[model samples]
Target: MATAATSRGFTMPFNLRLRRADVATLNDKNGVLEMRRKKRRLLTSDWGVVKCCCSDSVVPIRMATGSGNNVEKCEDWRFDMKKSQNSQVVRAPAMRFASPQPRFISKQDKFFPRCSPRNSGPQSRDSPPKRDTGIANEKDWGISLLNENVNESGTNEDGSTWYRESGEDLGENGYRCRWTRMGGQSNDGTSEWKETWWEKSDWTGYKELGVEKSGRNAEGDSWWETWREVLHQDEWSNLARIERSAQKQAKSGTENAGWYENWWEKYDAKGWTEKGAHKYGRLNEQSWWEKWGEHYDGRGSVLKWTDKWAETELGTKWGDKWEEKFFAGIGSRQGETWHVSPRGERWSRTWGEEHFGNSKVHKYGKSTTGESWDIVVDEETYYEADPHYGWADVVGDSTQLLSIQPRERPHGIYPSLDFGSTPPTDEPPDESSTSQ
Candidate 1:
């Protein structure tokens, strides 16, 4: 290794080599050019310069051929040893080399193999094995074991909380009512004591008496003292009779038959009379049933207007009281029978024209009369008759019948009162007037 410093302030180590032919030129007068294996050239300078006598020496020569040839090759070569002394030596650049560190296997990785189901046997340490007990040995199981022991000990029979002492078994009820301690005192009180019978209603009275035998009294027997004595055969019979009377009364008033008997007997008793119908003047002036019946009957009357006679003769007042009352309001005159007016002359004429033709009168007595003898007329007929006796009497046969023939009238042509268009303009010339 060779170390040298450069002018650039860096030191480096490098290898050096010299050529065999340049060994003799090692003297310090002139510098030697050393060439090695066609790679690089190294120069060493000499301190001295030789003055030659021959001109050939002035011109340096280099051999161009042959392997053994050795000649100095230079062109105007000059050397300064003093300057060379100060020149720094050159060395090749240094390089840092690095590589990844090698790795070794750890102990844990080497000793323990990878876990796989195919390579390893079943796990023995992970979970404990399940045990099987015989069916007869049910005591080894969890909840089932406890239940079996409880059954065998007969604890479940009288309820789990109950326990009987030795030589003291459960009663016929399979339950213990009382528990006795080994040396406990007897239930009977010590020293003098008295016996007393009590009536529950008179607790203080019974307590004051030292001993008294209670017997049936006029007021009533106490239920707590003697329940059997309180209710006798006669008392039961009286209750039965009262219940029968109530049921009989309920059946009479309800239209529902016996359907509402229970509800009526229970809630409706106070509001009902002895006859069991709801009382009048209680919630209202009359019973609801009476009002309901009235409404039902009125509804039937309303439907009666659909009758054909009412619809045609009476118009909309068919089943109502309007037509009859109107007829009655028109008082009779002289010996003539009264008649009811049609709603109005316009209404009468419209209705009449719809049922009858325009013919005023004919041999058949007005074309408007149906086979049933009901009068019918047209707008012209009603207008002609309206001024005479009103439309009412005009349509009524009792007041004025239809003429057998057309007639003449003071107001143009009109239905006849007798046979012609007029009401007899010449009254047959009175007999007295003719004689005079």
Candidate 2:
């Protein structure tokens, strides 16, 4: 007797372990899929189990769901290294319904297969190339197969798995400072790198600047940043942080980047874990941002990151125009995040919102601008109104009401609702909402 395959549109679980080097995949006419590296397939179909042969290392079990044409293209997207894992488990607000077909019409119903972070995305301008071929190299920058410390995994404890590259790709002229290849992987995600810019005395190798991100064989121009990661365990948990740290760095970069990160994580006896991270960094004079983010959890994902900054004098006539934006969003739901401060002024320039689907229309004191715009003004007091919930006092007592007065927008300019938060409205406004 045999069991039926999981439903096509089912919420399949993902569990994977990709060892070093490149892996080759073999999909036969039969419903079976096979992958091999370094010429080995110790475990075959007769055993009714699939094993990723890492020399002598064992990776236990790997689970993936699909039938017929439902192969999942696993992807580890947009990461900043230090907090990559923070964005992993986010279940977007959109509903994801499983169905018999490979693709689902609703953004809410779409499904994706287990992704290979190897082909995940861009790490840098030019370093570890992305692999599309079925074969995985022992030098692949993926998670290790077995949590073993021996050379049994076919690659060196460090060299093969932990891939690192660095050089100065900032500044127009050669002065100093540097990019440090501080490496380490996030709790459940990709690698992270760093820069040693603040220190002037502790310089190493290349001492100048301006090195190409790709194919630049310059020295002291070692101004570069990169990262790596490793999975931690219990029995191995007793091995002192240092020993494990060494074992990890030998196989990852996060070990080096760890000294510069603040991680939030929880673990249990069964090895289940949850992790989130926050970090800040600067690269030359172009990028200035700080991020507080986390993903791949039970509920949803949250992210608050500053945008890349810019400022310049065009022909000296525009007179030093500059702009910056700050944004915050959570999960796949639309109309939930906000972006502010784009025009270099908070008072006159309005911030706008972008969501996935429909938006609610809240009742606000009409502005010279649209109903959505909220011009900054001196605070006296104000009541709030929602479509579902009737007009109510903002601070305390629900029955109490606050007075409202309109303030002038900068330069006597007309107000516009194109920017700023626009609360959604699917239901009716409070029976008879109040006005200014």
Candidate 3:
């Protein structure tokens, strides 16, 4: 009977398409219409237990109303199956539904084949196959089928897997795999896979674990394999003090006083040369002057000098006085003459005689001779023009003497006897001699 039934089951070719909105509306109704409509053909067909595959059509069903109205309503709708040529369509029972094939059983039975060697063993469908252990231990599962001559086992005591024949194992650090010409199955029995082995450092970012331990010793000091050591307690204390002082100084000012001090300290510590000091000094000076110098004048005075008398007195004491003499000017210090102009020109003898009765000529003679010169005023008793003279007599020839008198005639008279021109020569003494 099972054989006859299997022979009666035939594959049908059908396509199905349903609007999601229609399905949602059908679920809102009583839904009996959808069930009856989906099974209508199967219930009436000649086949005893007909099975149907859903195709392209809607099925509506009627549901009895919960209300006491004694009325039935459309409750829901579902997809329907269509009969294809040489095949019969049937729906499941009202409470039954179709389901997809079971997955766990199929996977457990190795229903799907795998292509990897690691998955090709007898227990491949159960757990992953244990890697080949012929090269070494189970942990040293290497590519032994490719290079039979190589000992593909990890070097460390942990016995980890390895695929390369040469070079040190990465050990606790996992081995680095890369393409090489040495291990794997190929056309040749002695085929080589693309893999290589190198020390951890041969690649990147691999460091070795140290055998000797590190850290402090019994006296709470670092192990003394070398002289290098950390800062001492006193050194740290000094640094703390310096840092606190700096912070205090910084907080005390609106400007960064501590920054400047620290910078200077650092600069000093670095042993700057004279040139560096000079350069920084100039920079600071210029900065200060620019910020503060605009209020003053070129001479740096913002206030005018007061107290006229005091200023005059100060001027007299510290400044030179300009004095205009008759024909010369002089700048004199306390008791000594600082500067003198050229000597005044002498008066012509004619003008001197006319203005001062010839006594002026005698005075000039006295001044030049530096000795007492007797001049006859009325004869008999002669008078000395000057008592002091000496050394003044050293004057050179009087031919170069300048005349101080004005021109005679229209220009001027009385004060001058025409000194600009030759004066009238005194009448020569009478040539006739008086008889004794």
Which candidate tops lDDT? 2
Model 3 ranges with Cα > 4 A deviation: 1-166, 169-182, 188-192, 197-199, 202-436
Q: What does candidate 1 score on TM?
A: 0.08
| lDDT score, candidate 3 | 0.16
List, residue by residue over 9-86, the lDDT tens digit for candidate 3: 111111112111111111101111110111111112122233342221111121212111112222222212232111
lDDT of 1 by residue, 160-242 (tens): 22111112222221221111111111122111111121111011100000111111111121100100001001121111100
What lDDT does candidate 1 reach at residue 131? 9
The model with the greater lDDT, 1 or 2, is 2
lDDT of 2 by residue, 1-436 (tens): 1111111111111112212223344222221112233332222222223333211110111122221111222222112334322432211111111112222233322221112133222122212211111112112322222111211112222322223322333322222232333132222233232222111111111111111111111110112222222111123322100000000101112111111122232322222233323222222211111112112222222222211111111110000011111112211211111112324321111232222222221211222234344233222111111111001100111000011111222353432212225532212112121111
C-alpha lDDT values of all predictions: 0.15, 0.20, 0.16
- Candidates ranked by lDDT: 2, 3, 1
Off by over 4 Å in 1: 1-252, 256-322, 325-371, 375-436
Between the candidate structures 1 and 3, which one is better when assessed by lDDT? 3
C-alpha positional error of residue 20 in candidate 1 after TM-score superposition, expressed in Å? 99
Model 2 misplaced stretches (Cα beyond 4 Å): 1-139, 142-220, 224-228, 233-287, 290-292, 295-436
Model 1 worst lDDT run, 10 consecutive residues: 286-295
